[model samples]
Target: MPKTCFDPAASMASAALSESTLSGPTMGTRWAVRYQAPPDFDHGALSRDLALTVESVDAQMSPWKPESGLMRLNRSEPGQWVALPADLLGVLARAVQIGALSGGAYDAAIGDLVNAWGFGAVRDAPDPAAIRRAAASHRPAHLWLDIDGERARARKRMPMTLDLCGIAKGYAVDRMAQVMDRHGVAHALAGLDGELRACGARADGRPWAVALESPQEGRRAAHGVIELVDLSVATSGDYRHWIRVGSERLAHTMDGRRAAPVRNPVASVTVLAASCMDADAWATALLVAGPGEGPALAQRMGLDALFLLRCEGRLTEIGLGRFAAHPCRARIAAATPAP
Candidate 1:
């Protein structure tokens, strides 16, 4: 699970500033927002509107919901055109772009693989042939997007099982931040699961502090505290979302290249990008590239990243680019974790 390092000064400032925070259910997880607003801010009404906004996104993109808009599109036959909602089309477009950029390592077209691994709404033990077929079909390039009409069509051979699990939550977080901005709140912090985005700064003009957790299963220890200002942070880890199959722990992150659960030395990958959507997507991509190569990928993509690995119960942290800007206690561990 992701952890946040609470700054003591921020705690004291929280008491000094007039802040409003709201939390609610979203995307099989939860979302929370904290901002400095007017003393008479309509907390109840604003919270309700924000929750509905997230629910709308979930209805359009959740793979767990059989009747969701994305799921409905999944049910359509190949070569059939799907009149997708604006939001759904937007996400699909971004996913396809990122997939191609990462050489298919960050594909969002892996719903069948997700289901076969028992991580989706429908779960099944994947046979060898099914796994191969699923792996071969994870090419988002096969789907053609008509942005002008907000529609998408899959080629006859490509299965249209697009899974937005990695990106939707970040989009929701971005949407929530937009909602808050529309309501005239300037400085705010928002988060969904492990995806976090910040806008402006605190009332005292300091960055928001969040705890970065060690990638040790069942251990909620904070490995470092990051100060984010007007940027988004995301951590993708095998330990957080996984299944115990007999003696093996199967992670939710499937390698698009392998068409199987990723087997990398780095236990977790945290990326800081201009938007949460980019941070979220790239983290998964770099994690698949393995610890040895992930840092290079981040540097090439111009992303700031933090990676954690366990070697004989000792945790090692590696920071690249802007991740080194902060003087956290784990400052001098050599960069990159290798298997």
Candidate 2:
């Protein structure tokens, strides 16, 4: 179910409009779209179109596919330009922009680190040798990756592997929403994993609701609900994907500066933005920044973010921007410590 979920109450409303659900598998997870349509609406055609839209994204950006544009670019030699699809180039450009904005906290050149940590295509136990080698030779993607949007081409200036896992799913979700728009489905919600975008209000004229998951390692629970209207939400948490090492667990998300799994008190970070792509990338950047530096950065960037921290066996939350006014419902007995 990922973290974001539609409110069943609104979805189950039996109005003149009927609910149509479309779903398919992509990026090792399922994508779903729910829209309200008139009785005569062609849901079948819309479903097929939605599936194709996400498939196109997978084809261009998936690292698991050897023929994918991203993989081809990864295999290219330094200083060799590779003409890429517009969508891939756009995502790469945005990654570079966000990487610079986050002070290198968010990076797309961590493919080697992702694989070494067993979070990439080949899922195995973390390799100590690979981890050491990747850390020793790590560099931020912005410094080594070059993008020429006018030419729809990109090239690596150094030996680096590119990965788009942090933002690709959200971009796919955005593409799904665009497909719905093309089909004239105005009232809809589209999502991949925890990243979600709403085109408009539900059939009943209520804003679409998304649940925020509590960052607990062994279970799934809703920490809060956000009413979304023409907005996107993404959550990056340490609880979901991690590797256990003795008594400690290492998160899948890498801190580019450290070239290792993020080790901080921050358990999760949720961001709301106009685009799912921005929400997704910013959430990852803020999570890697942790409590010490995350809040300040979010404030400076004017991002709506909710940061959950695990302190002394209790959960603490610090909200900024819109989240500051609308705090999560789940509460612990202890007060939140200053970030």
Candidate that scores best on lDDT:
2
lDDT of 2: 0.88
What lDDT does candidate 1 reach at residue 234? 88
- TM-score, candidate 2, is 0.92
Model 1 lDDT on a 0 to 1 scale: 0.76
Q: Candidate 2 clashing pairs?
A: none
- Candidates in order, TM-scores: namely 0.86, 0.92
lDDT (Cα, tens digit) per residue for candidate 2, span 1-339: 124356666656637578888898999999999888889999889989988999999999998999999999999999999999999999999999999999998999999999988888878888999999988888799888999988889999988889999999999999999999998888999999989999988866567877788888788877778878789999998998998877988899988788888999998899999999999999999999999899999999999998989988877888887776544322222333322
CA RMSD of all predictions: 4.9, 4.9
Q: What is candidate 1's lDDT per residue for 1-339, written digit by digit as tens?
A: 133466787666655558778999888789999888767777777788789989999999988788887887778776667676878778877877777777777877777888777787655554567777777666554244323332353322355577888888888888888888888777899999989999877866667888877676776766667777788988898887888777887889988667789887778889888888988988888888787777877778777888776666566777887767655412333432322
Superposed model 1: Cα runs more than 4 Å off = 1-17, 122-133, 136-157, 325-339
